[model samples]
Target chain A: MQPNGQLSRFGAMKVALHRLAFVVLVAAAFGLMLLGKADTVLVTRLSHAVTDALAPVLEVMSKPAASVGAVMNNIRELAAIREENARLREENQRLLRWQTLARQLQVENQRLRDLANLVPDPRPRSITGRVVADTGGVFARSLLVTVGARDGARKGQVVVAAEGLVGRLTEVGARSSRVLLLTDINSKIPVVMEESRARAILVGDNSNRPELAFLKAKAGVSPGDRIVTSGVTGAFPPGLPVGVVASVDEGHIRVELFIEEGRLELVRILDYGPDGIIADPGPGAAARAGTD
Target chain B: MRPTLWQTLDQTARRLIPFGLSLLLLLLAIVPMTTPGFLRAGPMITLLCVYYWAVHRPDMMGYLGGFSLGLLEDILMNTPLGVSSLILMLTQMVVLTQYRFFVGRPFLITWWALALVALGAILLKALAIALLSGYVVAPGPLIASYVLTLLLYPILAWVFARTQILLTKEP
Candidate 1:
């Protein structure tokens, strides 16, 4: 109502519509759920098309959230300058000592390599993309990256963040790809516990910490051990950083992922060739993989 | 006096504000909240937004509008297509059935009713996820989100009220 008690010419929708249409829509929703199971290929195609079509809208929309995050981070950093300075000072001293040790080890490694005439694995090609959207709610843990077949992005490519291996490109479209994060139910990565070199499958159960499956009995695994891809399945490169063992309760070992999904903004998709099979070969390729 | 075609279209667009604003909130829901503990349970803005319209201006956000909004959310959020549509339409229909009771009630009573409806809706969502994805989500996050979404209702309703006034004011 206005000052004169006059209603706006456009605002009086004071009644609900007919009930038949509501019933039809609800039934259609039911049909959609059934359709997914009956025809997964069709459902997958439709979802991909929808994601590809909305990629630009998501890209444009995400910029504002990122800007807000940056601003807030700046304020937070300003507030904790003194504390951060103290922490950095101590970290610098520790890193300086590790730097010396690393140099010595590198020299010894080089000498050994020269003596054995060892070969090194060539680097894989990679493309970086911005994360546009991720599955909402607790239903799924996949990300829509703003790169696709048009940009040379392909399915099965390993996606990594600055810290380490994040996930893999499971679905690729013309303008976007769905990265199935390491925390999804369907994801399983062949990994090795670095301390003991025991192999296992890193399985996700839609939780923050994915668990280790098929681990060898009495494998000497403990808390704080590193986990890396073993490259056994011919899908991922060996020795890529994955995570650290977070716990070992009753033979269940969970890994704390290196990449926090909240902080993940950019991801690099690496094509390690169609075959991850490491074998004896000539000057261009073979089993001489070395971590830099 | 006969209104022109443009005037009629303008009137229709103005009435579509509730649906449009709810769609915008739906998009914002998918944007990962930097806030801890809230990431897993996104703010269920669409639920309350649709409820608000279904109670106050049901003619604007009819079945078609609710269906389209839910379908878009499904497509964008990577849920089984139509799950959201079913949930939203059902929510709207439920609210419409109780329209008379909520028509002139105080904000608190309407909010109290929302808590009940939202709890049911969240449980349904969990069931859908479990059935579709085979992962039983922890109940803690779902309950936490239910409370948070209810807490956010007053603020969203206040904004919708203002917009409704603007839309209905004599031009």
Candidate 2:
């Protein structure tokens, strides 16, 4: 629409402006990174505000994803129904038998507790929340739940699915919270071998299976050993089922967590009370909660 | 020098299309898909949008739009604030600088260029994340994401092209 010479001049100006914009943007981003590093509270507040604003929209967007997941699950479930039915029938019979024994043990346990006058720990309370977003990718593992500080969700609370420990509540927003899954590289939980009572740390490495670390020398942990929360760290209550040791190689002991992070829909956040190991997080604790 | 109301509204709508599309991409990236392997390392859908808009409508989606979208992603994904912002801003710069070569290329050529750009951008993102987190991120999943993003680009590009047509054809 213009003369060639004029068009070329206009093109040069546009390109120059774009280059200048690029430089300004890069510099601004660099400055933000430095700001993020120097002031975690500011970064956390910024993240929280942004996440809070987007939570409702993200929740709406995730509905189709959840339905697709449900449909896929139904298809998979349909494939082996006959064999699964038989297996479940047999397992139900076995569970019925164990139910009788468990009742007897409960009666005896109550009597022993009465005799010993042991002050029972308060039963942990829980609040349920829906998964609104999944931030996991190749590098980090985390999910944003629909519950937040207004719902009494706090940092360091244990998040669980029906199967077992999902992770811990790391960041609590005004209307949303971030759950750091146990498979995240930053996740570390204290666990004990159910059979052997040997203590170790469950460390995530951004894989489906987390590894057992800092096991005592000659602790005799083997594949298939059931692991549970030791309650020693006070972060998690004792006896919560964690996972089974999947393998015991020369140096690595991997655990397949009972929770399937992919199928997570509703998660329960457990409040272990004042005496619980996770200290009551104060104002600045939000920024420091993920550090350790 | 003031424009009529309809012209102003038309210009506003045109300007918003790229930003709105890119924001939609950012939202899509975080959608919780339970499908194994797909959601774990889902294609970088937002990155594809940045490249598409940079190629087709650089006037509308500038470095600021790229930075804002990238920052939104970083906040949503809970990564260091500027990691994605920096990568996306640079992606815009790269695509715009090479715009002349790509302007009239065949589809395959553009596709290949996009794949290469995506690969480099994702690799740069990985390096930045590792450096920021002070941990060596495993490259296995990153490579998987890169490949998946490359494979899905054509489909996404087609979608973006349709949206562009819609934007340009609006009265």
Candidate 3:
């Protein structure tokens, strides 16, 4: 081959390589997007792995920053003490009423607990974790908590806050796990409308309010209706408060989550598995079983 | 006169500046992911950085480089995969076409133009996501983010320029 022809051929090869690289990168980006939508498992794993690897460095860096932020917040609060005082006064009255209701509910809850214990499987092991980071970027909604497989934080474990359902643990590492926020576009929870018991799919759209999909038009759902996990998918337990209906538009309803994303500082990871509920004994089964 | 070895080294370093800056910008773009409500505003910081580099260093920050950085941002930020890449490539094209006008402009004017570009990039990204996903697109959050990015532009631009100057100084 002539020298010029060989040089030109090499140039063509270089261009081909560049084009191939571009194709691969674009394909990778598309795969990631699809992955982001299809399931939370991969994201959860990536998040836990990344954060676990980076946590020590982040801890060292964020400590001083957090302390500085706290100091600034304190200063701001001091400046607005009068306004805060008034708000607190109003809140205290509300708390008093809640306290009264809480006591009554606690007693009733104890009675129900006793009844449930008599049935079986009264105790379920649970672990508590603090939300160390809510670092899932705009397209991905996830929270990194300080509990992982080492702490019995298994995949698909339901995470709840003091208020209500937070999300399910999608991935777990040795000492950390990723909680796919209910608002992630990839998140879909089988939920039932509290008032009409209408079954619908709660789909996240990377927004504060998740859209209710596949809801029956005649479901008679209205604004302010509560939503809870139906446990139909055998992932989350039934009857956990998920969110409340914020707005109902044509063919889509939005939920105002009970657990605020910004304020999720701590959560309890339930140890319950797919077989959450134990079957109750049939009528006369107790006596028959005793004889056996 | 023929370029000296020192001149060649300086030129190489000058070209390398944008690449390093883009990485840092990509990291900053992902910072909002750590905080709630940060990502909804669009990839503002990223748009700004890409615009700046495309204007200042088009030779280095070409189509493929811009696209790759956008893709990396998407992976790190966990957004729709091609969303940032599409926006970035478009922004790079726009900035590259108008590179000459921005090269010698005053810092404030440069910042203002960047703010405008950031706003446009974000709006386009939001519209694309909405159309693709068939999701209920709220204009409110996008608007809020645009305003915030505009307000943040001068500070970020200043920091970026300072870093470039500090790093590329002739020893």
Tell me the alpha-carbon RMSD of every candidate.
5.2, 5.0, 6.6
Chain A TM-score compared with the true chain A, each model in order: 0.83, 0.89, 0.69
Among all candidates shown, the one with the greatest TM-score: 2
| Model 1 global lDDT (CA atoms, 0 to 1) | 0.80
Candidate 1 runs further than 4 Å off: A1-17, A39-42, A110-119, A274-292, B1-3, B32-37
Enumerate the candidates' DockQ scores in order.
Answer: 0.56, 0.62, 0.22
Of the two candidates 2 and 3, the one with more favorable TM-score, higher being better, is 2
Residue-level lDDT of model 1, residues B6-119, one tens digit each, is: 889888888788788887676665554334445555667778888888888877788888888878777776667787888888898889887788898888999999999998
lDDT (tens digit, per residue) of candidate 2 on A205-267: 787788999888534877888999887767887788999999988888999889877767889
By the lDDT metric, which is better: model 1 or model 3?
1
Give one digit per residue, the lDDT tens place, for model 3 in A111-145: 98676544333245689986655544344677667
Cα-based lDDT at residue A16, candidate 1: 25
Model 1 lDDT, residue B59, Cα: 73
Identify the runs in model 2 with alpha carbons over 4 angstroms from their true place.
A1-13, A274-292, B1-3, B34-36
Q: lDDT of each structure? A: 0.80, 0.83, 0.70
What ordering of candidates by DockQ runs from best to worst? 2, 1, 3
